[model samples]
Target: MSEVPEAEVVFVVADLAGYTALTEAHGSKQAASVVTRYVELAQEALEPGTRLVERAGDELLIVADDAARALRVAARLRDAVEREPLFPTVRVGIHAGRALEQDGRYFGTPLNVAARVAAHARGGQILCTEEVRRLAGEPDDVEYRPVGPVRFKNVTDPIVIVEVVAGRRAGEPTAVDPVCRMLVRPETAPARLPFAGRTYHFCSFECARAFAERPEAYAEA
Candidate 1:
């Protein structure tokens, strides 16, 4: 077989949060149906030059030659899922770098980093590497917040993360406590839990402790 080429591309990974708990709370069949719906929505959101590489369980891996296009598609996918209440919240991550592409599959650092970034994102959030931010340039009507440097497993050095805020409504800043499902102000919340790429506020220390114990249990709640 001919050797596949290596090229610079934007890698994106969007994972469904609370997938395991959703399966347990509902059933495998219902969870499977949600996954199917997510896949369909993803297909609708991808751009012309973008390619869907694979679906790893509740995650979707995609690739695009244009960094800006990839960011746009990722934002679109997030928005699409957000509009559907039946679908679970999804978190997205994007990275731009050179990678090996063989037989329609990608390998190397870019893909690995993208996966790591996605792992850091909170449900309903979009996180991306600084490289992607630079490549994509400044977007209109979209806010980008630096989330500081994050250390990922097996990756040397720290990667800076940027949160993409495109469709969020401004004013009245209130965050939902993952443990108790209560809304609280970040400034007034009695306790806070920082995990992955986001900070979660809680009404009480007890609720924060509960979330710390098993975060995935409250990911969808």
Candidate 2:
């Protein structure tokens, strides 16, 4: 057995919401594809100081020395998942405190609390403890709304939880593909087509071809 190393760090756990239902609806193979994509997207979204502790099915445990960066990474993960048409929304929970690391895994009150907080979050929501907010400070791009003290199983006392609000800023232009419903930027879209007297953008050529094949199938009613 290895000794547990203690350190003050920020922990984040992100899990796919309604994963079981998605799997039931789409079968295991499709669900696995979504999970694989989510893991890849998360790895790309994390900041330099963050390390992926481990992955448990549809959930990922990540740690970082910078609390603010952890929060930003959570936001980015959520946004990335939202932009994927095949994946469900992700719920993220963050906490900053002293934790114990053993065998490349984290254990301690902070880690447990973060996992519990993640369970409380709804689809596409990011919840964090008050300590995380204090350490991270206020973010200009996102608003923090207090959800009040929440009680978790196996934890004494109520923990103050806050929701991180991140949305498209004003005047930010966005386009959604009708075939897959994924957000696409007009300038960088893989494929663009004119249909029904309007221009449509797609993330992939396959989606553009599908739309072109049956415009009536994807065209808005």
Candidate 3:
């Protein structure tokens, strides 16, 4: 067996939220297509900044130049997939401290931290370490909510976390779904029906119809 090489590499861990539900609901073929599409979309958004080297199950391992670019790409990945039906929401976990490279694979505390971040994301969010935030350029209206210190599954230090706000396009105003707490586009979700003036976005027609069926019920809730 070859020895692990210590080269201080930065690793990225990310995944799709509700992926299992999607797969079970759509079946294997459809699930594969959507998962593949999601991977492609994320790759497209993170290209030129990070290179995807390994894809396993619903998780991805990407190596980047440094912590800064990794965090940037994480935000981009979440933004790229949040609106698409392929993946409801993408969550990212990034820890950019150090890693050992062996046989073209990266391993270390950073990688573990990133994996934990990805694991902890609620929905359509990015969880990253303070080290990553240190390298992250600047706050551009993206809320970096502090998640406090967390003791990860592996490694020593209790990593600090900050939630990365999803990126928005130019000339676009962010819309939040009052019902389910998801961000949606005005043009994309115009079909959504609601009360006098306010509009709500549901993950699917089922959610919309459910809301429509009991307007007062959801409105009050």
lDDT of candidate 2 over 1-221, digit per residue (tens): 66666899899999987677566544689778988898999998888999887999999999999988898899888887777754466899999889877768787899999999999998778999999999889877878999999998889999999998865533232676666554466888889998778889876787788888988977776
Ordered from best to worst lDDT, the candidate numbers read: 2, 1, 3
Residue-level lDDT tens digits of model 3 in 1-221: 76755765566788866666556544678667866887887688675657888888778888887766776777777767765642456678877765777667776766777888889887677887778777765656555778989887655777788887646744333554434434467667644776756766654565467578767755633
RMSD from true fold, candidate 1: 7.1
TM-score of 3: 0.73
Ranking by TM-score: 1, 2, 3
lDDT of 1 by residue, 60-123 (tens): 9999888778887888888787666445668899998989977678889889999999989987
- Model 1, residue pairs in steric clash: none
Ten-residue region with minimum lDDT total, candidate 1? 167-176
Please count the clashing residue pairs in each candidate, in the order shown. 0, 0, 0
Top candidate (lDDT): 2
Residue 28 miss distance in model 1 (angstroms): 0.5
